[model samples]
Target: MQIKRKLTEREQKLLQILINERNKGIQEIAQLAKTDIHDLKTIIDSAIDELDLSFLNQNKEIDCTLISAYNEKLKNIEHAIDRLAEGNYGSCQKCGQPIPEKRLEALPFALYCVNCQKKKEEKNKEATQRSYPMREEI
Candidate 1:
């Protein structure tokens, strides 16, 4: 019979810590997202009533930006929890590799390894650049 080796003490400890983080991240992010989103519409309406055209436009824009950011975080946090349940919490979704402990600790909801993350960022930058019109086309 092939016996599975046991995880080292440190690895076990790190797993427990990650599980804790996954739980806490889910709870905290859910609450934060709900609160932020709940007030978004009301805040934008208030800004329209209380501010001049320029300020109102800016305030509404800022409110939507914040809500979108929060929603992204909430989505990541929830997905992290799901990954933890699936026994792959610390693995990179893109590379199928274990994400570094430090990176996972710093961003429990991270979806990619460092190298993959860099690549993804580079691609995003390229896409952004391509979307802009050339001066002549403008």
Candidate 2:
């Protein structure tokens, strides 16, 4: 039988540092990593580049928008953390089903299972479309 590797203390420390220094400059994380500046810059730069590609498409003006989005995402994560502290993190918010441990491990901020999340997203999309329906010539 294969056992899953629980996140180690060192790994947890690294993750904590990374999360806390997310808004700080690369030099700070480099110092924490105990690595050379160039190597630290490369790691931070690559992560930022990947994030830009995914969220901002490298547009400088969209930085504020990305920040807002990130803020909202963080709020959700905070709510999840609150649930975790309350001993309710793994249950689906909508259906009360137990969220899989694998899913929770992959995304500690997740508040819903796949089905509940999809349903909520679909409902939100429908509401958005209804609120701003496109006009078509008949």
The number of the candidate with the highest lDDT is 1
Clashes of 2: 0
Over 1-138, each residue of candidate 1 has an lDDT whose tens digit, in order, gives 111445555445545665575345344433534535334434433542231223224443245444445445544544554455556667789989987778877877678999999999999998887898668867
For candidate 2, the TM-score is 0.42
lDDT of each: 0.56, 0.53
lDDT of the structure predicted as candidate 2? 0.53
TM-scores of the candidates in the order shown: 0.47, 0.42
Off-target runs (Cα >4 Å) in candidate 1 are 1-11, 19-82, 134-138
lDDT score of residue 127 within candidate 2: 93
Give lDDT tens digits, candidate 2, residues 1-138: 111445445334433433443434344433434446676455444554333323333445444454445544444544444444445556787899876666665665667999999999999999998888878622
Model 2 spans with C-alpha error above 4 angstroms:
1-85
